[model samples]
Target: MTKLEQIERSIAALCPKELKAFAKWFEAFQADLWDMQIEADGQGRQT
Candidate 1:
């Protein structure tokens, strides 16, 4: 299976507390990714 699929499976088994923590972490991770993409765009880097 793909790495993403494997991660999905792992996430599916998280306890409520773990899930909440993961959710928080994911939000920050996505935000950072978007910030980097925007900075790259501003610098004229091809995505």
Candidate 2:
């Protein structure tokens, strides 16, 4: 199976606590990605 499919299966098996932690981490990761996008935009780079 592909890596993305593997991750999807793993996520489906997470317990409540684990899912909460994963969601929190994903939120921070997305925020960091957005920050980088904004920084790139400020530098006039096409995202």
Candidate 3:
């Protein structure tokens, strides 16, 4: 399985309470990473 799939499976095994918190944190972290990539790439553009 892919790395992400593996992580998902592991998260699914967690207790519901922990899983809910983890899901929210993971989503926010991923959004931050995506935003960082967009900003960095924009800075590197040839003009």
Candidate 4:
């Protein structure tokens, strides 16, 4: 199967507690990505 499918299956296997922890981690990961993109955009505008 594809890599994304593999990840989906793995995530599906997580227990309730593990899933909650994963969700929290994923939320922070997404926020970090957004912050990086915003910083890059600001730098580009300055140049």
Best by lDDT: 2
Pairs clashing within candidate 2 = none
Weakest ten-residue segment in model 1 by summed lDDT: 38-47
Badly placed stretches (over 4 Å) of model 3 are 1-10, 45-47
TM-scores for all candidates? 0.85, 0.92, 0.66, 0.92
The candidates, ranked best first by lDDT, are: 2, 1, 4, 3
Alpha-carbon error at 3 in model 2, in Å? 0.8
The per-model lDDT (C-alpha) reads 0.96, 0.98, 0.89, 0.93
Tens-digit lDDT string for candidate 4 (1-47):
99999999999999999999999999999999888888989888521
Off by over 4 Å in 4: 45-47
Q: In candidate 3, how many Å is residue 9 off?
A: 6.4
Q: What's the CA RMSD of model 1 in angstroms? A: 1.1
Using alpha carbons, what is the TM-score of model 1? Answer: 0.85
Per-residue lDDT of 28 in model 1: 100
What clash count does candidate 1 reach?
A: 0
Q: Candidate 3, clashing residue pairs?
A: none
